[model samples]
Target: MLKFVKNHMESIEGVATYPMISLLIFFVFFALLFWWVFTASKAYIKEVSELPLENDNNQPKEDLL
Candidate 1:
Protein backbone atom coordinates (compact mmCIF):
# COMPACT_ATOMS: atom_id res chain seq x y z
CA MET A 1 0.00 0.00 0.00
CA LEU A 2 2.84 2.39 0.86
CA LYS A 3 4.58 1.70 -2.41
CA PHE A 4 1.36 2.26 -4.39
CA VAL A 5 0.82 5.66 -2.75
CA LYS A 6 4.45 6.65 -3.26
CA ASN A 7 4.25 5.72 -6.98
CA HIS A 8 1.16 7.85 -7.51
CA MET A 9 2.60 10.81 -5.63
CA GLU A 10 5.87 10.67 -7.58
CA SER A 11 3.94 11.02 -10.85
CA ILE A 12 2.49 14.42 -9.86
CA GLU A 13 4.31 17.59 -10.91
CA GLY A 14 5.55 19.92 -8.17
CA VAL A 15 4.85 17.33 -5.48
CA ALA A 16 7.94 18.50 -3.59
CA THR A 17 6.25 21.80 -2.69
CA TYR A 18 3.21 20.07 -1.15
CA PRO A 19 4.92 19.10 2.13
CA MET A 20 6.42 22.59 2.58
CA ILE A 21 3.09 24.29 1.94
CA SER A 22 1.32 21.93 4.35
CA LEU A 23 3.92 22.61 7.06
CA LEU A 24 3.62 26.41 6.57
CA ILE A 25 -0.17 26.28 6.88
CA PHE A 26 0.03 24.13 10.02
CA PHE A 27 2.52 26.50 11.67
CA VAL A 28 0.54 29.65 10.80
CA PHE A 29 -2.68 28.19 12.19
CA PHE A 30 -1.15 27.21 15.55
CA ALA A 31 0.69 30.55 15.84
CA LEU A 32 -2.53 32.51 15.31
CA LEU A 33 -4.35 30.29 17.80
CA PHE A 34 -1.62 30.83 20.40
CA TRP A 35 -1.73 34.60 19.84
CA TRP A 36 -5.51 34.74 20.25
CA VAL A 37 -5.42 32.70 23.45
CA PHE A 38 -2.85 35.06 24.97
CA THR A 39 -4.50 38.30 23.75
CA ALA A 40 -8.09 37.41 24.67
CA SER A 41 -9.65 39.35 27.58
CA LYS A 42 -9.61 37.67 30.98
CA ALA A 43 -13.23 38.61 31.71
CA TYR A 44 -14.41 37.14 28.45
CA ILE A 45 -12.49 33.95 29.15
CA LYS A 46 -13.99 33.67 32.64
CA GLU A 47 -17.50 34.16 31.32
CA VAL A 48 -17.00 31.51 28.66
CA SER A 49 -15.44 29.11 31.16
CA GLU A 50 -18.37 29.44 33.55
CA LEU A 51 -21.07 29.20 30.91
CA PRO A 52 -21.92 25.56 31.60
CA LEU A 53 -22.15 26.17 35.37
CA GLU A 54 -24.48 29.15 35.05
CA ASN A 55 -28.16 28.51 35.63
CA ASP A 56 -30.73 28.99 32.86
CA ASN A 57 -33.26 30.15 35.53
CA ASN A 58 -31.21 33.32 36.04
CA GLN A 59 -32.06 34.48 32.52
CA PRO A 60 -34.90 36.97 32.16
CA LYS A 61 -38.05 35.36 30.79
CA GLU A 62 -39.34 36.60 27.47
CA ASP A 63 -43.07 37.17 26.87
CA LEU A 64 -44.57 34.83 24.33
CA LEU A 65 -47.62 37.02 23.75
Candidate 2:
Protein backbone atom coordinates (compact mmCIF):
# COMPACT_ATOMS: atom_id res chain seq x y z
CA MET A 1 0.00 0.00 0.00
CA LEU A 2 2.79 2.40 0.89
CA LYS A 3 4.62 1.62 -2.32
CA PHE A 4 1.52 2.23 -4.41
CA VAL A 5 0.85 5.50 -2.62
CA LYS A 6 4.44 6.67 -3.09
CA ASN A 7 4.35 5.89 -6.82
CA HIS A 8 1.01 7.67 -7.23
CA MET A 9 2.24 10.69 -5.28
CA GLU A 10 5.22 11.08 -7.59
CA SER A 11 3.01 11.13 -10.68
CA ILE A 12 0.38 13.60 -9.47
CA GLU A 13 0.26 16.78 -11.61
CA GLY A 14 -0.37 20.34 -10.44
CA VAL A 15 -1.83 21.01 -6.93
CA ALA A 16 -4.23 18.08 -6.49
CA THR A 17 -3.19 17.36 -2.92
CA TYR A 18 -4.75 20.55 -1.56
CA PRO A 19 -8.14 19.73 -3.13
CA MET A 20 -8.02 16.19 -1.70
CA ILE A 21 -7.19 17.54 1.74
CA SER A 22 -9.97 20.12 1.52
CA LEU A 23 -12.45 17.42 0.52
CA LEU A 24 -11.37 15.30 3.49
CA ILE A 25 -11.84 18.24 5.87
CA PHE A 26 -15.26 19.05 4.47
CA PHE A 27 -16.32 15.40 4.75
CA VAL A 28 -15.27 15.29 8.39
CA PHE A 29 -17.16 18.50 9.16
CA PHE A 30 -20.32 17.25 7.46
CA ALA A 31 -20.14 13.95 9.36
CA LEU A 32 -19.84 15.71 12.70
CA LEU A 33 -22.67 18.11 11.84
CA PHE A 34 -25.03 15.29 10.89
CA TRP A 35 -24.16 13.37 14.03
CA TRP A 36 -24.94 16.40 16.19
CA VAL A 37 -28.25 16.95 14.36
CA PHE A 38 -29.23 13.31 14.87
CA THR A 39 -28.48 13.43 18.60
CA ALA A 40 -30.24 16.75 19.06
CA SER A 41 -33.34 15.50 17.20
CA LYS A 42 -33.46 12.37 19.41
CA ALA A 43 -33.20 14.44 22.57
CA TYR A 44 -35.87 16.82 21.33
CA ILE A 45 -38.21 13.92 20.61
CA LYS A 46 -37.65 12.44 24.03
CA GLU A 47 -38.22 15.77 25.75
CA VAL A 48 -41.39 16.45 23.77
CA SER A 49 -42.77 12.97 24.39
CA GLU A 50 -42.25 13.32 28.15
CA LEU A 51 -43.61 16.85 28.34
CA PRO A 52 -47.39 16.19 28.13
CA LEU A 53 -47.28 13.38 30.65
CA GLU A 54 -45.17 15.38 33.05
CA ASN A 55 -47.45 18.43 32.76
CA ASP A 56 -50.73 16.51 32.71
CA ASN A 57 -51.81 17.13 36.27
CA ASN A 58 -50.09 20.42 37.02
CA GLN A 59 -50.81 22.53 33.95
CA PRO A 60 -53.72 24.99 34.23
CA LYS A 61 -55.96 25.83 31.27
CA GLU A 62 -56.70 29.42 30.40
CA ASP A 63 -59.62 30.89 28.42
CA LEU A 64 -58.50 32.38 25.11
CA LEU A 65 -61.37 34.87 25.09
Output the number of the TM-score-best candidate. 1
TM-score of each: 0.76, 0.41
Model 2, range 1-65, lDDT digits (tens) per residue? 99999789878785578889999999999999998877777778777776765545645334222
Task: Note the Cα lDDT for every prediction shown.
Answer: 0.87, 0.76
What is the alpha-carbon lDDT for the whole of candidate 1? 0.87
Residues 1-65, model 1: lDDT tens digits? 99999999999999999999999999999999999999999999988887776567644234322
**Model 2 ranges with Cα > 4 A deviation:** 1-14, 41-65
- Report the Cα lDDT for residue 62, model 1: 45
lDDT of 2: 0.76
Which candidate achieves the best lDDT against the true structure? 1
In model 1, what lDDT does residue 56 have? Answer: 78
So what's the TM-score on candidate 1? 0.76
